[model samples]
Target: MERISTCLKFYLLEAGNDGSIEHVDKALIANLMTLFFAGRDTSGALLTWFFWLISKNPVVENKIIDEIRQNLAENASPKHIFSNVQELGKLVYLHSALSEALRLFPTGPFLLRVPNQKDVLPSGHKVDQKTKIMLCSYAMGRNAEIWGEDCLEFKPERWLSDKGGIKHVASNNFLAFSSGPWTCPGKELAFIRMKAVAATMIHNFHVCILDGQNIVPSISAILTMEHGLKATISSRWV
Candidate 1:
């Protein structure tokens, strides 16, 4: 794949400006750099964490497999594309699992925002225009005060209501893809990619964690698996 910045630069140069275009090179460069980093960096870590979670939680993986089988039915042909996002959305359990995974290990880990004017937060914390605030999404998601005593548990079902639609998590409760207009535009695409990769893997193999592997979470702007997720994949046919 061509380097993102190089491709972006080519496009920008192609769209010549005869005093009409704004000096958007710097902005485009910044945004492209963010996308490159977010796309490659967060995605890998998330998948690693996801497999690790599934390894220790066989029941979850099994449910995912069952969902895939039921959805595809007799057409177990691996080459077929599951083209409908709406149909994919019917895999409610998988959606919950992914959402729960992201909640526990938010890709961005923390959100930093500077106050434009003096204001007080809901928690009664006062801030001025210059004050920089860092909201620890990783920590907040796991906080008992925020998510209840069982916050640390890997329970995908928690994200579903009895009626079986998207549950209404508090606005501040889970901000993995974030909220409002600032929310990730690629959120749906990310879910599609994640679901496709996961469904493919589950259909092809049974995954188990390597014995005695120590996996740890590291926070450095992004939530990453410090030791990495080491697992053994045995082909399903075996």
Candidate 2:
């Protein structure tokens, strides 16, 4: 109850005078609860795919480790926790890597929404109030026309600009977080959390994916490893 109230206060600001009571409609509460539950599998799915990509591309993993060392404080221990997200924010390569992974493997296979009014999508298709709009994010992520010929390749540098910063890809192009007025408000927080966890694990351990595991994405309702990740973990110092 306390945690839910805190979240309501932070995000919705609808926690009432005592800051502990939800003053929103029941629909809003249901949606908030859905977000909370959905977010967990989404996080786990992204991390699983990100690490799998890292394993397949040792060069990319090495670059991420190098970036971690560079951005980390000099005297910080291997187990250092990122108290300030600004520190993790400096890891451009790592961020790009995760973005690339998501580009290839969006956890949410598709997005479903009902149009509030009749409208035309950019694709020239007409949608009516009765239309149920479905956007297949997985297909969008792999579109060579949109992402270029090398779209199938796992290249983090593609997300970088000529100035060595994260390039601006339109939200519509990057549908991992959706687009327009209904875009996710928690996008920034999600990235920060992902960076912190990935950085910490990369800094402290030697993670190796063991053999004999079929690591394909499951056809389940929520995207996840079909057979689960068969991996071995050991301390870096070992």
Candidate 3:
């Protein structure tokens, strides 16, 4: 709550809460609650899945570690601080991996809402004024019709273009942060934190998944590991 209040105060300062802000009391509470619950859960779940995926694939894991090491070599004090945002932003492979992971296991597997007015989605789905809708981001991500038959495969290279640049991954297919006015504001922050944690952990240790452990998704609005992901970590340098 303290963290939420602190962030809200910063927001209020940035927006300059004028007399017109009177009607925002309930809205503020709702938004704060949404952030409080959504922020931590989504990030935790993402990192869990990321680690699990990397553990299963040593080639990918080595690639991430190599990137981190390369970045560290360029930094004067890599353990203390991130030297530059430019370098962080250039983590194209990491970004692609994260995108792939989000596609496979979106935090909010499904989104629910009712249309405020009659509308037609790009997918040609028509909704009347009071129609309730369930947009399955999870299903949309793995749909062979949209992403090809290998949609279920974890391939980060799909997010890169032939020019070796970060490709414009479509938001319609990947709605982890959602879309439109109700999208998560902390999307960038969450991605940065997730990538940073994954890079740091992979660079420092080699994670080996314990044998025969059934790691499944939990039943919740926010995606969580059904069983806590258990893995053994060995020092990478060794």
Candidate 4:
């Protein structure tokens, strides 16, 4: 609250310099509300799908556990868990797995945009200011043309490069976090939070999707589980 208050004060001062405080508080409050919802809801949705994916693919889960164990051993941390950003950065496989999950089930499955003028997209689609453009990232992620034959498969290895580092793809192809100047400002922070939660959970517990449960994406503005994930979790240490 202090930080927000400080930022509000700064904005007010800047606006005061321009000789107008009209509606500034309301505008700031609206922006703060938008930021809070965007960050919280989207990250929550991402984690929901992430854990569901891991539950279905135990091999991938095991691989993530192995990576975490290897990194912890090399760091020789008495805590047996990632304690800092530097340590969290070493979980490359975990990062890839999360990215893979994002690719398949982007929080905002469709991106809506309005063009300022008439234009032709690279795909030769013509658009004008009146047209409502909806980019379906979920479908794009599964398209064979964009992601190859195994696009539908949950394969985290695809995000790894030949040198064992995370592979970079054009933002246009991976629209989970959006693209261009209007891209998400909290993208990096979101990744850090995700890595921390995913790593910590996997390191300490084994998650299994309850048998015979049908898991499907919800029909909504956000990608959430249609039927919330049912899973059995057990301690990995004991």
Candidate 5:
């Protein structure tokens, strides 16, 4: 309530400058709707894919559980587990696993762009202003040239540096959150949310993907499982 009231006040103040409270209100509403949908849907999809990937790779799941337990300690209170970004930041392996999942199954799998002017791509392919180009992030992520021979494998270690820290990749090559000025504003929020939820879940539950379930990406604006993930989750906590 306090945050909403504060936002309303700011919107009204801005409206005072242009004498357009109605327009400002509409814009504010639209912005709120976009934030809610984008934040929830994309993060939900990412979590789904992340869990599926981890299920298929028990080593990765065990590593994540070990990391989370080590960071929070075995007797840490449930209320305080991964309660802050600082603590969550220390889960480097968890972060790497999330990154690997995003690499394979990006929520926004395709991006469309129209060049403002005639241009030549690195491939020497000519494109003009009228050309509409669709860049497939899913295919790009699986490309051998970009991700090497084992690109199709779910390997979180690939994102870890020799020193065991999260290795930064160029945005052009890793477009899970999009790139440039138009990048998703909630990118950081999404990571924080995912980490908190993932850590808490993994710390308390043993998630198993039901055997023989055929999972594939659905045809939608967001990358979702075609049949959804069929998983049996059991409590890990005493």
Candidate 6:
């Protein structure tokens, strides 16, 4: 095995060129530490699962690449990809693919909550005040009753409308970001960041998972790859 790096380095990936925030050593370390838990980084885990899924589904990847090309400006070449988050929103297929990945492998696989007052759930279940309610986002996402027979399958079209637009799905049905008033406030920004990175990477490089690798998920506060992901990257332009 080859070592990409023998020492750790902070790669601060900024979304926009607006400006950079100045952070002291303590603040920077604290922020980075927040992203790690149980000795694993949540982002790394989610991305590992995403890339693993993408590798198994070549057809899906091809569609994502094709959609990126189609969304380019009329005068732009196929390789001329979106340079900002606003422009990246037009890549519908890529968005769907990402949603599909999260559906199957949510970063925060479980969400815990405590009821402020006694209430009955939609399912007619009664909850006591101050009682803990644990929602397994991972399980609900793959529920056949909610998503039908193809729930387990990686089909990005499930998120598309008849006319080829993004189909609106309730967070209840897709609890990747939770539901109702307490949903994730950074949902839109998260999507943009992911779309920006994924679009750029797929357009500029060909990512493939190495063969004979036993890829599996780990049990933790944030879902992570049991064994780290091993893959190869090569530039598409030659």
TM-score of each: 0.80, 0.85, 0.80, 0.82, 0.84, 0.78
Clashes found in each candidate (C-alpha, N, C closer than 3 A): 0, 0, 0, 0, 0, 0
Judging by TM-score against the true structure, name the best candidate. Answer: 2
In candidate 2, list every pair of residues with a backbone clash. none
Q: C-alpha displacement of 57 in model 4, angstroms? A: 1.7
TM-score-sorted candidate list, best first: 2, 5, 4, 3, 1, 6
Off by over 4 Å in 5: 1-33, 73-75, 78-81
lDDT by residue for model 5 over 1-238, one digit each (tens)? 2444555576567656777778778877876676557678888898999998888889899999888878995577754456687889899999899989999999999988888999999999899998998888899899999999999999999999999898989888988877776566666667778999999888878788888888889998799998888888887655
How do the residues 16-130 of candidate 2 rate in per-residue lDDT, one tens digit apiece? 4444544445546775776556567787899999999899999999999998888889888767776576798799999899899989988877889998889999889999988
What candidate 1 gets wrong by more than 4 Å, as runs, is 1-37, 76-84
Error of 6 at 88 (Å): 0.3
lDDT of 6 by residue, 1-238 (tens): 0111111132233311334455444454554454333223544566667778888999998898888877767786646555676579789988888888888898889899889889999989899876799999899889999889899998888999999888999888888777897775446656766777788889888887889877777878788888878888998887
Report the Cα RMSD per candidate: 5.6, 4.4, 5.0, 4.7, 4.3, 9.2
Error of 4 at 213 (Å): 1.4
Cα displacement (angstroms), candidate 2, residue 66, comes to 0.5
Worst 10 residues of 6 by lDDT: 1-10
How much lDDT does candidate 1 score?
A: 0.76
Order of models, best lDDT first: 5, 4, 2, 1, 3, 6
Off by over 4 Å in 4: 1-37, 73-83
After the best TM-score superposition of candidate 4, give how far the Cα of residue 142 lies from its true spot, in angstroms: 0.4
For candidate 6, give the lDDT of residue 169.
90
lDDT (10s digit) by residue, model 3, range 84-140: 456567677887888888888898999998988889988898888778888898899
lDDT of 1 at 131: 95
- Candidate 5 yields a Cα-based lDDT of 0.84
Clash pairs for candidate 1: none
